[model samples]
Target: MATTPPVIQAKITSDPVKLPLAPLLVSVVVGVVVATAGVGGMICYLLRSGKVPIRVAGVAPVVPTAPLKTHMVALEPLLVNLADPSGSAFLRAGITLSIEDPAEDKGKETNAGEAKPSSKDADAALRDTALTVLGQQTSDQLLAANGKERLKAELKSALAEHNPTVKVADLFFTEFLVQR
Candidate 1:
C-alpha cells in the first residue's frame, strides 16, 4: 500500500478595523466644546437668576450707620414708703437713665434768649417724679412676677410727662430692695 501525503491548508487573516482620523478628532473636539458651552450657559443662567451671588473684590461691604450716641445719667437711690395698708412696706431702688447725648444737638439752632435747665434741676425733677411713682406702688404689686417691668414702664411714662425736655431712651434698675 502507498502512503498519501497530508494536504496543507493556507491560513486566511482578516484586516484590522480602520477609523477616519479627521472625523474622529472633529467629533471629540465638538463634544468637548459643546460640554464647555453648556456648563458656561448654566453658570450664566444661575447668575442672572440671582441664584448665584457675585461678590466684587475691594468693595467695602455695606455698613450700617453708627447708632446714635447715648448718655447715662445715674440717679440717687430712693427710699420710699409703699401704699400698703399697714404703711410699713418700703422700697429702696437705685436707677440709671439712658438719654440721647446733648452734644449731638449742638448743631440745631436755638433762640438766643432761651435757657436750658441746669443738670441739678433736671436731676431733682427726675428724683421727684420717681419718688412719686414709687410711693404709689404697694408691696403686693411690687412683689408680683411682672412687677419690675410694670414699674419701669410707669416710671418711663411719668418721666416723659414730668420732664419733656429730657428724653429717656431706657431705664435700668441698678439696685432694688423691698421691706415689709
Candidate 2:
C-alpha cells in the first residue's frame, strides 16, 4: 500500500498582475472615441441654441429697389490735369447723367418735354463735379483696372450732394480718354 504525501502551502505575492497589451490598447481607443463624440455633441447643441447668429444655408437677405424711370442729361467734354506733380497726365471725359424722368415726376405723358432744371444750370453743375473728381485722380488711378467704375461712383455721389432732389440714376462715359 502506498502512503499519500502531505500538501504544502503556496506563497502569495503583493505585486499586481500584468494586464494584456491587446486589452489595454482597446480600452485606450474606446476612451478616446467616447471623448471625441461627447465634444462633438456639445458643439452641435450650442449651434442649435441660436446664441450665435450663424447664417443658415440657402437663405438670402432682402434688398430694396427703386422704380425704373431714367433719363440722361449730357454734359460737355471736360479737360483737367491729373494729380501728377509735373502735370504730365490729363483726363478728357464726356459724361452723361441719368436723371429721374421728368414725365414721371409731373405725372404727365409727353413725348419730348424737357426736364425741369435749365440746361445751362444742370450742365454747369455736372461739369464742375466731374472735373473736380477727374482732376483729383492720378495717372496710376485712372489706368487701374477698376478706376473708371470708381470714378463713376464718386461722380454719382458728388452729383447727389450738389442736387439732393435730383436723382442721378447712373453715370455714363460717352468718351473716356486718359493722356499720359
- Model 1: per-residue Cα lDDT over 44-83, one tens digit each: 9999999999988999989898565556789889999999
| Residue ranges of candidate 2 with Cα displaced over 4 Å | 1-67, 102-106, 112-117
TM-scores, each model vs. reference: 0.60, 0.58
lDDT of 2 by residue, 1-180 (tens): 898898888898899988799999999999999999999988888889976578779978878875667777888888889998778999888888788765446565546676545467767777777788888999888789999998888888988898776779888999989898
> Which of the numbered candidates is closest to the native, going by highest TM-score?
1
- Name the candidate that leads on lDDT: 1
Runs with alpha carbons beyond 4 Å of true place in candidate 1: 1-65, 103-118
Backbone clash total, candidate 2: 0
- Model 2 gets an lDDT of 0.82
